[model samples]
Target: MALTLYQEASCGLIAGAAEAYFSFPFVSACLPRVDPTTLSVVLRAKYRNIFDALYSMSANKKISALWTNAGPYVKTRMGTNVGMLTSYNPSLCYLRDSCGLSETRAQLGASAVSAFFGAACSVPVKNVLAQGKSGSSLDCALKILKSRGPLAFFSGFSRQFALVGPPIMILWFAYENVRKL
Candidate 1:
């Protein structure tokens, strides 16, 4: 539930978890495993449905006004502050023990995986709410909300720039400043 693109990018991608699970002695010794673009169509279809459904709910009227400033849907979830340090423990542990992927690669892989997961999980919802829109994308998410104002938050679009952008940018910029310090 707690995967951050920033943290992943800041570190790296590691496949230790998959490796550990995949490396069961019986399977390792039993047969050969080959990587394939083999996700089930049924699974993929479910994700598409979920995306469309959840995306809309983010904009639903009941979202806590407290989160009215939770940032964009993606931002609110992955925004740097929301992630904090605590959430990285599992991944860090996984990286250290289960997977040997470099911190940077592990993070990057995590981000990529998250994106894929998002596509899979939310695709269904997206299709339902925003399907048929020409090339639905992050930009489209913003565009739709730009004209929407307050209600936009419910759409889970929060336009998040206000709540999340400044703090995140500040941290990134601070890191840059620290390099000189």
Candidate 2:
């Protein structure tokens, strides 16, 4: 039962949505929380104190959670879709043609490579999400680079790679196997 291009695209969309839905809460939880009171006071006399009012709103926590996680969620979802679309066929072809690997082996290799690239690309977005600022991702990346050095962008790469890689590989392997069946 080979999947058509449309079916593959639909699967990618489903996977992206599921990944965003499931991972967002964990991502939100990891974000640094701003102390509402402290933030309010600091912004009280600055620029008409809009920050204070915004941070002090009754729905502050929910709003902050959404704000902090939304960008990363979108980034991650898009990255997932792109990674799957870009890597799947290429990896399969490369592994099969260049390496003379079996279909299963090619799939596993492709999945592993895709997971690695996905995790690598997500480092900056993860950092920005962890900081939970309303600023742009570019600004956050620049701030980390300036304050913590160029390598700061990949600060938690090892840990995140360890956490994310195996599951992705497993999921891809399982999906390919199931599809074969």
Candidate 3:
């Protein structure tokens, strides 16, 4: 009935990849509208809404433009899911068995650890994605590196992680507890 770490990681990776791919269209449409730096791009382009953004992008550019940074998006998603999923069981076991924590406390601890790593893994990519940079993911990456160096990716990590960490912790905590039932 239990899944091994390999199985868990594989499941997480596949799920993350699929989620990113399927959601990229919506994400691509929304990011420019919300990201202040890119909001002007949306406004000047006169995209009224998500549909307008999608329509304009597909009409003016290749349909593939809709998934401009999908590679990095999917990579980040996989890292986050793998961080959460792969760490869950081992961390849970360590907390409960080695650390002598109660079921509830151990579950909470494990979930916290998982969320921390998941957010850590995704923060850099989120920064890159938020920039709404044009080009393939790799090109965007190289541009950032050329302009700002490698550490540029982690630029707003602390603030971003603070915002995202709690929600992800709550998510894993709820999922773990609910799975028990």
Candidate 4:
């Protein structure tokens, strides 16, 4: 019952779309807290917590404001999921069979590979979101290109890779082992 790469990508696309749509509001609310520079741009007022932030955003700008960057977020999620899901199993099999790694080591290697690839694919869109710049994804991308150059799209890439890799490794390690039961 193994999935083809296309099937994996399809699954990833649907899952990522749903995840981005459902989570965008909460993510939008929390972003200003983690990246305070966004406060003046996004909220203009500091709230005590996420719920309060959501409430104020909805009140001040309408509920739709919470999804301001939905398209870009969805693109980021889809890229990450497609990159990870498409690569993970083959990477695992290669490490396990060709590299002759132990189960734990194979899972770890595969997850790290998947995470790095996914982060690389998604980080450009993520940078756009993090910047909280107005306009469509294309417009924002163009602005960044004109102002900061292509590398600006990957400004925090190493930090993002570090943040993404370990969680994915832990997840794959745990999930693969448990699924064997």
Candidate 5:
């Protein structure tokens, strides 16, 4: 489970930041505004924030596919996503448990993938919501939750204790700091 606030802040910050950088409105004009009522709402919000951070960080464009499997190295990239994150951080957990790696090595490997996913997740939500979806949307959100193998959405996440957690502590600090300043 993710820290609810980080999930909220991560999504909101990324979306707002991405829009600020790209100068494109990534929100749905007629999508009933945004109401953070459920998990989907939270994720939708996260997508928006991540997008902004991706743009704000000025990260490379090549990793764009990792956001949604649109790149040439998508499989490997996604595999890295699943491989590194599924167990624990790609570095610490994988090496210690899966590959018998040392602490340093596993952390390094996981850090790399974390950077990629962090960047990708930080991407601005380019997919605008339709007034009513011109076509049947694939419910990618649901798909993200349904899979069991390879692209297993967010399942088998025995180790996903904090999907996007620590950043939240930073958020609370920042919130306090900003308000004071």
Candidate 6:
């Protein structure tokens, strides 16, 4: 069963929210810190480490979840939908036309491609948040590239892809099932 556009968007939004909420901490930890002093302070702080880490790892999140979490999550979710569609369309075309796959197989293959693209696109956004930078995403991206090198964008990619892929695949699977109903 094919999902209507609204249903597909809803599924993507829900999945993105869940992914962002659950993965934020781990994603933050994986980013490279510009200030080594911050890491040391957090480590040596013992019981205060959590607070220290949170403060350093995010944009003064102690202030408000809306600024620190929800806002970014929504932005990330919207970005993800764009990334998915960008990748999915091309992958679907390749799978169907080049590989001569059936419609179902093509969709599944395209979805897998979309998941990888979405996860890859998310890395820089996560890096920006982890660094507690309030700049535009482009500015943050350039900062990462300038300060940490091109690889900085992919700092936690392996871990992130491992964590992100399943949920994406599951979301698509569930979306398909729901559309059938």
**Clash statistics: count for each candidate:** 34, 0, 0, 0, 18, 0
User: What's the lDDT for residue 40 in model 1?
Assistant: 35
| Candidate 5 C-alpha lDDT tens digits along 59-149 | 4645432243222123222333332233233334556688887655555555545444433432212121121134333464343335433
Q: Residues 1-181, candidate 6, lDDT per residue (tens digit)? A: 6565566656666766776676666455544434445644333223345556566545545544423435676656655665564666567779999999987888788878888877787766677766656677787777878899988877887776786677776766567668779
Q: What is the lDDT of residue 47 in candidate 2?
A: 28
Error of 4 at 132 (Å): 12
Residues 34-66, candidate 2: write the lDDT tens digits. Answer: 566675323222323434434444243675444
lDDT of each: 0.38, 0.67, 0.78, 0.81, 0.38, 0.67
Q: List the residue pairs that clash in candidate 6.
A: none
Better of 4 and 6 by lDDT: 4
**Of models 1 and 5, which has the larger lDDT?**
1
Pick the TM-score winner: 4
lDDT of 3 by residue, 1-181 (tens): 8899889989889988898898889887776544446555544365788788789878967888888757867877887787777877889899999999998899889888887777776776776665645766677777788899988887876775686668777887888778889
Better of 1 and 3 by TM-score: 3
Residue 103, model 4, lDDT: 84
Could you tell me which residue pairs clash in candidate 3? none
lDDT tens string, model 4, 60-86? 576788887578778888877777778
lDDT head-to-head 2 vs 4, winner = 4
Model 4 off-target regions past 4 Å?
A: 33-49, 60-62, 124-156
Q: How does model 3 fare in lDDT?
A: 0.78
What C-alpha lDDT does candidate 4 achieve relative to the native structure? 0.81
Q: Model 3, stretches more than 4 Å misplaced?
A: 33-41, 44-65, 123-156
Task: Give candidate 1's whole-model lDDT.
Answer: 0.38
Model 3 earns a TM-score of: 0.66
How high is each candidate's TM-score?
Answer: 0.25, 0.60, 0.66, 0.73, 0.25, 0.56
Model 6 ranges off by over 4 Å: 1-69, 134-139, 177-181
